[model samples]
Target: MDPMKVEVKKIDELFRLDGYLKPFEREIRRRHGVLREWISKIDQLEGGMDTFSQGYKHYGLHFQQDNSVIAREWAPGAQQVYLTGDFSK
Candidate 1:
């Protein structure tokens, strides 16, 4: 139970998740070509990881560390959006 082993295991877990998400990602790209294209661009942007992986940004998509949905939608058109959620109250 060495510390290096622990780090390696964690990295392996991420690789597994990356592998698992890879197919779903492809499916997403197929189903939502435009969104997938935007996602690819976002991945290229530094701000995206901050917004996607952490709640440190006040814009774009927000996701938990594990990628559980917190919020999203980079769409800026059709001004005036709403989130009818329990958090509103």
Candidate 2:
């Protein structure tokens, strides 16, 4: 089993357990399509879902061997930004 492979199950499987869900199948499938699109976009843009989900490991503050600290934030719509901590003072 490859870690990067995603196994997708049929949407009709849910209806097997509960027939009441039959009416909502269309909406459920639409939502699922949107979700699949997002997943595909993440895979193409960020290597894969595994790498995209683990962004915290690469995006946040990190310490260097020279005792220097680096801080990083991913705020795309911010007009201004400020970082405060004991080190900031």
Candidate 3:
């Protein structure tokens, strides 16, 4: 099998594991409220915070002829970034 195929399989497994762990962790947090404890342990892993996220996106709100979506990303560390998509076109 190709290296890219192996990589895709690895990513797919990781995503499925995360899906299973989400409910397990949610129940633990619901029963114990151990956010701080988990944070301390999780901090040792690189990019652990990026692994789990909670966000709300306000899409398609009432607007007057605005095909142009003003996308704003709050990243001070970013030097340059560009958006390219069918929506942006």
Candidate that would win on lDDT: 2
Query: Which stretches of model 1 miss by more than 4 angstroms?
Result: 1-31, 47-51, 55-89
What does candidate 2's lDDT look like per residue over 8-55, in tens digits? Answer: 366557778888988876667666667788988998988998999898
* Root-mean-square deviation of every model: 15.1, 7.3, 14.9
TM-score each candidate. 0.23, 0.70, 0.26
Q: How many steric clashes between backbone atoms does each model show?
A: 0, 0, 0
Which segments of candidate 3 are over 4 A away from where they belong?
A: 1-34, 37-55, 58-65, 86-89
Query: Worst ten-residue run, lDDT, model 1?
Result: 1-10
C-alpha local distance difference test of each model: 0.55, 0.76, 0.47
User: Residue 25 CA error for candidate 3 (Å)?
Assistant: 16
Model 3 lDDT tens row, 1-89: 22222222244465576876554543443434345447656766533565433222422223347564445555568999776667533
- What are the runs in model 2 whose C-alpha is more than 4 Å off? 1-9, 63-68
Best by TM-score: 2
How much is the lDDT of residue 71 in candidate 1?
A: 65
lDDT of 2 at 45: 88
